[model samples]
Target: MSARFVQQLPHRRERVADWFARPGAVTRLTPGAAPLTPRAAAADLAAGETVFAMPVGLSWRARHDPAAFIPGRRFADEVVNAPWRALTGWRHVHELADSRGPGGAGTVVVDRIRARVPAAALHGLFAFRHTTLAGDLAAADRLAGVLGIGAGVGREPGERLPRLTIAVTGASGTVGTALVALLGTAGHEVIRLVRGAAAGPGERRWDPEAPAADLLEGVDALVHLAGAPIAGRFTEAHLAAVRDSRVGPTRRLAEAVAAAGTPVVVSASAVGYYGADRGGEILDEDAAAGPRTEALAGIVADWEDAWAPARAAGARVALLRTGLVLAGGGGLLPPLAGLTRACLGGRLGSGRQWFPWIALDDLVDLYHRAALDPALAGPVNAVAPGGVDNAAFTRTLAEVLRRPVGPPVPAAGPALLLGRRGAAELALADQPAVPARLVSMGHVFRHPGLAGALRHELLRPAPERG
Candidate 1:
C-alpha cells in the first residue's frame, strides 16, 4: 500500500531542496525525539549511495536507486536490509516544487512511499517529519534575517567556518546533548569529556574534582555543563549537592582551562542568580545577583564567580544565565504539559509573577553564539526578548494543547511535593530577564513567542525523547 504527505514552507523550492541536499540533511530531518543516530551519511544523494543508522539498537541501512533519482526535483531510497524486511518493502520518495500564494513565493514538499507497514502507524511519523522540516526552514529564514543576508543564498565552494577542537563536560545532559549535536553538524570536532571510562577516541575521562593536568591540552574551547540538577525536592542534602557540584567542579575546570591556556570558556548558569523574589524589575546581564539568603541565588552567584580564574588567566569567559528552557524530553515542560493535557493546568501561586523562558533551539543557538562570538564575554541572560507572566504562560500552553485553563493551582501542592524552597524558587520566581546584549548584537530568536514555541515543543512527535 502507498502513503502520501505534503507540506508547504515559506521558502523557494530551490532553497528547500538545497537544504535537503546538504550533508547533514538526514540528521536535521530526524526528530530530536527519535532513537536513531546517523552512523554514516552519504556525501550527497547521488545514485548508488547509502546512509546508515542505528535506530533503537538495530542497524538500518537505506540505498539510493539511480534510476529513481531526478536532480533538483526528487530522489528515492529503498530499505535494503532489516529484521522486518520479509514483511515490508519500504521505498520512499521526496519531491519538491515551487508555489505561490497570498503568503508569497514558497515551496511545496511531498513525501510519497509504498510500504507494507500499516498506514495508520505511518501517519504520525510523516506528520512529525513534515513539522520538523518546516521548523528548520523557519529557523534558517529567521537566522538569515538576523544576519542581514539573503535567504537561500548557498555558501560558495571552499567557504566554511573555522572549526575548533571543543571539549564539553556533562555531554549527556539536556543542553549539552543539543549543543554537541549542533556543533557536530557545523563540522566542529566535539570531544566529550565524561566521568565514566573513556569509551573511544571521541571520549576522554574527566574527574571534575581533580581534572587531569593535560586535560585541556590542544582544546581550543571548553564548555562546562557539569552540575547536579536543581529540580528535585529542596532538602538540605539536595541543596548542598547542588552548591558543591557547581562551585568546586566549576572552579576546578576553570583553573585547569586557564592553566592550559584555553582561549575561551562557556559555563552553564541560571536566572536563579537574580533571586526568587524579584518583583517587576527588568533584570539584565549587569543586574546585581540575588541576596545571599536565597539558597539558589547564592549558588548561582558562586558558580559565576568560580569562572574568575579563567578570566584572570586571560581566557574569555561567558556565563550563560539561562531561563526556563522549553523542550520535549526534560526541563519544566513535561510536568506543565502533562498537567495541561489533563485539564489540570493553571497558573501557580500568584500567576502575576513574570516567567522568563527560552526555546530549546534558541538556547542551543545562544550557546553556539557564546562560543563563536568574541563580543559575548561575561554574563549573558539567555532568555527570550519579551517576558510573559505565569497566567499568560498557562493560557498559552493550554490554548496550544486545546485544553481548558483550570483554576490557579495554589502554592500548597507544589510546596508540599517539592518543599517550600523548591516551590518558591522554581515555580514562583518572578525575574523578568531580557536578552538586552543579544538584542543589541542583532541576535534572532527562532521561536520568540510562546505560541510558536509551545506548538513546536509540545505538538511535535517524540517517539524517543533523546
Candidate 2:
C-alpha cells in the first residue's frame, strides 16, 4: 500500500529545492522534539548512499535508490537494512515542484510513502517533518539579513564525524548527562568512568589516585568533567574536597592519558580564574589568574595547570573556562527560580557585580566545538556575549517568572548561607568576562541575551510589556 502527502511552502521551487539539496537538510528537517536522531546526513542524493540514523533505542540506516532520484524534482530513501526492515514495504519519496497558484513562485512538497504501516500511525511523523522544514527555512530567512550570511551558508548538519570511542569521567553529572546523551545519539560509543565496579560494555572503574596506564588504551578522546560542585556553604573541608576532586583527579587523568597516548583531553575550568574583585575589567582568555587569596581563583589556576601532563604527552588540551550556566534541571536557575516564585528574588549585595552567563545549550555546544575544533586550544572562555550585572539578572528572572521584583538582599544573607568568602567571591564578585576566542572563531549562540536565555531555560512565554 502507498500514500502521498503534500504541503505548499511560501518559497520558490528552486529555493526549496536548493535547501533540500544542501548538506544539512536532513538534520534541519529532523524535529527537535522527536526521539529520532540523525547520526549521519546524506551528503547528496546519489544512489546507494545511506543516511545513518538512530530512533531512540535502535539503529537505522536509510538507503537511497539511484533509479528513483531526480535532481531538483524528487528523491527517495528505502529502508535497506534497518530495524524497520522487518516491516513490509517501507520506502519514502520526497518530491518538490513549483506551485501553479498564479504566482508560480511557491513550492509544493509531496511525501509519497509505500509501507505496510498505517497512514494514521505515520501522520504525526510527516507533520513533524513538514513543520520542522518550514520553521527552519523561515528562521534562516529571518536571520539572513542581520548575520550577513544569507541562507547561503550551509550547516554542517548531523554528526558527520566517524564513530569514536570516548571516555567520560563525569558521565552522571548535569553536563555529563547531556553530553553523553548527544554522543550516544550521534552513534559514538561512550565508556563511562565510574568509581564503582564496571558492570557493562560502556562502563569502566576508575581510581583517579591510581589510574592504570592501559585504562584508556583505545579511547579516541577523554572529557574530564568530574568535580565537586562549586555551589555550597564553603567550609574548610568543602574547599579541600573541591581542590582534591579537581586538581588531583585531573593530574592523575593527565598522567593516565600521557601513558595511554590519548590524542586529546578536554578538561573543565572556571572563570573564577579572574578572581572575585576584578572590578570593571572585561576579562578574556588571556587574563592572568587573579589573587591567590581568592580560593576559587587559586583552585582554578591549579586545576588548569594540572593538565600539563596531558599536553606534555603530545595530547592536545582544551580548557573550558566555563561561566554561570543557565539551564532548567541544574545549575543556577532552579534555586533562583524558587526564590522568584516565592517572591524573594532580588539583587544580591550592591547589585553591581558582573555576572557572566551562558545558556546550557550553548555551553554544551561549546564543549562539542572544543572537542572538534582543532584551532581551539588553551583556555577558551565559555560564556555568552552580553555580561549582565546582578541587578539585571535578577530583574530578568523575575520578569520571566512574572513575579514582582523585590528589594536587594544584604550581603550578610548570602555570606551566612554560602560562607563569608564564598559570598564575597561568588555572589558579590565582579568579573565581566567574554567569549573573545569563540566570537573570533565565528561561534553562533542559541541564546545570547539575558531575557532570551531566561525564557529558554525557564520554559516561560515571552514577557509582556506596556
What are the per-residue Cα lDDT tens digits for candidate 1 across 1-466? Answer: 8988888887667667766776456755554444455556666766654554565567667788778778878988887885645568888898888898886677888889898978876665576567656655564444444444553334411113456788999887777776776666555678999999998877889998899998888898898888999988999999999999999999999889888999989888999999997768899888889998989999999999998889999999998898998876567888888888899998988799888999887887777667766777999999998679999999988887889998888878789878999988988888988999988887878778888777666654334456
CA shift of 67, model 2, Å: 30
Quote each prediction's TM-score: 0.81, 0.69
10 residues in a row with least lDDT, candidate 2: 151-160
lDDT (CA) for every model shown? 0.79, 0.77
Cα RMSD to native, each candidate? 5.4, 9.5
Best of the candidates, TM-score: 1
Q: Can you give the lDDT of residue 36 in candidate 1?
A: 53
Off by over 4 Å in 1: 1-27, 32-91, 94-110, 115-159, 460-466
